[model samples]
Target: MNSLELGAIGNCSIAALIDGAGTLVWGCFPRMDGDAVFSALLNDARTAHDPRAHDPREGTFSLELVDQLHSDQSYLANSAILRTTLYDHHGGVVEITDFAPRFALYERIYRPPMIVRRIRPVKGRPRLTVRVRPRFDNGGIRPEITRGSNHIRYVSPAQTLRLTTNAPISYLIEERPFLLDRPVDLLLGSDESLQAGIETTARDLFERTWDHWRSWVRSLSIPFEWQDAVIRAAITLKVCNFEETGAIVAALTTSVPEAPETERNWDYRFCWLRDAYFVIHALNRLGVTRTMEDYLRFINDIVEEATEGELRPVYGIARDTAIEEVVVPHLSGYRGFGPVRVGNQAYLQVQNDVYGSVVLASTHAFFDQRLGYPGGNTLFEQLERLGNRAVALFDKPDAGPWELRTIASVHTFSAVMCWAACDRLSKIANRLGMADRASYWRREADRIHTIICEQAWNPDVGSFVSTFGGRDMDATLLLLHEVDFLSADDPRFAATVDCVARTLKVGDYLYRYVAEDDFGKPKTAFVICVFWYIDALAALGRRQEARELFETVLRQRNALGLLSEDIDPRSGELWGNFPQTYSMVGLINCAVRLSRHWEEAF
Candidate 1:
């Protein structure tokens, strides 16, 4: 069975997930948003329809250690390299080092579209079998294989992959176990010859890559406490960025359901403006401005190319504006459910918060001196266009932050974000020395804030509800203090926090809301909402309770110290897409907020 508790190894462009037993179970080729080359995570349920169907093993790339009794996996400190060790009952041991090479090669970065695996004997005579199977076009078709003297080429309609290995090709093809002798290097990339001896080159690349990652981690301005968790979260978030165009995907995989059998599964490979904005803010706190700058460029391009009327909440990594939804019937869902989906229909919906998200992201360019393109009057005027839209749509109806498909309401969270946009734009205009524009934006923000306080507060419930004139408690109410809409000491804000905690809190986990949507009630806790609850706890002066809650959520990370989008509150099992950007962002934000000051530590 494929383990959802998986380790991920990637180099900015492409990433692959390895099961606890160290088998490559999930990965996409070319880019983070590309087709899954290893689709075994979603098993082939088509076998049930046909007795003579091909074996399902073709979707996975596994390394089978002969007579293996136990396996262990971990990442090298402060780096993306993954090391898995397998031990046989007879005292034989083997180690597998997996990484996608990324370093400063010459004057540029050498993050190739490849996964490198190095296998070596640690003790005794450990024998092994290597199974290499790569599917194409979302696991609907298997690529044709052709062998040469030192390599095997997988030919598909979209692209070609060449596996250059020092291991015996005959043994690999026939699935035969061979005696342990020397180290073997497997280079999986485009059809090309390796420059140096396989083992020598692999060793050099591994060393350089390790050094590069460690250097990058050392440069981050992280909190003194929870250094390990913060570092891992930062690394995972960094790899999720598609560096070429500066687009950061929400998650690497598609169709991983938010809950079992809810059919709530949607492709998360595209960039959501709201999610990316939060991600940038979290990274900015760590003094990691490169990602923020890159993402700004990506969002800027989207803003430039948008059709006249309104902005979308999500966009493709390559900036493909229209993403029509589709379901691939051939492959089963994650863990053999059904309906593996691709593309997101959410792009077509008018999410009013997107204007706020865009303005928030662009606002950073004005204050941060490290950016190449700093904001000024020209940029401030351009951002006024987005602020104008936020003003027009603050009270209008559209899909809110939750993206409910069935109904539309004046969501309190959406309006608060609009208020935030105008509020921040007012500050930016003042900083740029434009007093008139600053006053105008401040006046608009005050108008929106006053109405929200009047309409969104439910007197009978004694709480600020999810939507105007409604009684549903949303976890987003927890963010009211973080966004500066309400002061932490405000009585209404305190009441709302207590109300959301009482209603949405399930054990230590918090659900987005209790109300049923088009699919029915949510069965799992959205991970980020729980983090927001942690932050709210801190803001409410419950520091000890907040610390305990933060540590409790940290325990829910998978074996690789990574988190997904949601978790089963009952079982504590992770659900949703792997290495979710929102979850990682939550980790960073909470750590920075809750950690003791460096001076106190000293």
Candidate 2:
């Protein structure tokens, strides 16, 4: 079976998921939202009832070391490169390094749609087996294979894949074991001949890619504490970005259910405004502005396309305006769970937080001088339209961040975001010397803030309610301090934090909410909410407790130091979409908040 103990390797373009045993279980080629070329992670179904039900060697590209006794996986420091070592019974060992080549080429970033694997013997005589099975259209069809002198090509209607390697083509084609005496290199990409020898090309790309990533990490302004964690999180975030259109997908995969039998799975390959906003917010703390600038352009394109002053919470990577949700019946869900799905229906729902997200993201363009598309009067005018929508909808009920389909209560989080939109717009206007507009937005912000305080607060519970006057509490309230809606020391804010801590915190993990939603009660804790709680605790002078909890959350990350969206609270197993942007953003945000300054550390 495929494992959540998975490591990710990407080049800010395409990505793949490799298990602890050095198998490529999941990957989508060409782009983040493309059809899965390696769908074994989802298709391979082995159950207790039918122990040999599915093909054991069907969907993975694995390097099998004969007589394997032990295996482990980790990423190269400060890079997306993954290294997996397999040990044999007779003290033989083989090391496999996996990465998608990314570096500077021809004055532009060279991030090809490819994955490279280099294998070398570390000790004694080692035997190896290479199994390559690639499926097309979400594992529904296997491509037609054709062989060349030293390469193999898989062609389908969707795309063509070529595998160039130095290993014997006959052994690869026959899926047979062979004794390893020399290093082997494999590069999987378009149908093109290798300009140099396989070993020379792979080694050169590996070294350059390593140098490129290390240099990029060195350029980051990370926190003194948890530097490694923050760096990994940052690199993961970068991989989520689709450099082609400047859009950042919420996650790389789709239909990985949040919990068993809950059917809470949703496709997360599309970009969500709120998720992107949080990503920018977290990365901004690291002084990394490239993602912000790219995302700004992406958001602007969405804003510019608005015909009726309306925007969806999510959009396609190529800015496809409409995304109709569909379920692929052929491929079973991850682990044989059915209803593998694509496209997101949340785009159809009205989410008020998106307006605040757009404004918050756009407002930074005005202050950051490093941005290429700096904000001006034209941008301000466009954003004022969104602020107007925020003012009109903040009090009105729609789907909040929880995306409740049946319920539309006046969510306080939505209202607070509306307040944020106006507040930031007012500041931005003031910065631009638009005195009258600044005053107007400030008045609007004050009005919304006052109404939220009056209507959302429940004196009976001594805390702010999730919905206006409702007793239910949502985890989004923990962000009230981060948005500057209230001071960390404010009695009401602290009381809200305590209330959420009591109601939502389930032994260090926080649920999005307790109440039943579209998918009954959420079975797993949302990882991002728990991170918010840690930040809340740090804000409330519970630094030691928060630090302990933060460390616990860090430990929950997979062997590759990556996290999915939800977690089994009791077991600490990752669930939901793989390499969730929100979870990674939370990692960076908490690290920045809790880490000591470098100057002070010295």
lDDT of 2 by residue, 1-602 (tens): 55578898999889999988898988888877887888777664547564425675676798998999999888899999999999999889999999999999999899988999999999999999999998888777788999998899989987889999989999998989999888999899877888988898999999999999999898899989998889999999999999878888999888888986778878999999899999988888788788898888898888888975688999999898788888877666677765678888898998888899899989889998877779999889999989999999999988999899888888899899999999999999999999999999999999999999999999999999899989999899999998999999899989999999899989879999999887788899999999999899999899988899999999999877889999999989888999999999999999888988889987
Worst 10 residues of 2 by lDDT: 44-53
Off by over 4 Å in 1: 44-56
Per-residue lDDT of candidate 1, residues 395-419 (tens digit): 8888789998868999999999999
TM-score of each: 0.97, 0.97
Q: For residue 587, what is the lDDT in candidate 1? A: 94
TM-score for predicted model 1 compared with the true structure: 0.97
TM-score result, candidate 2: 0.97
Error of 1 at 140 (Å): 1.2
Write down the worst ten-residue block by lDDT for model 1.
44-53
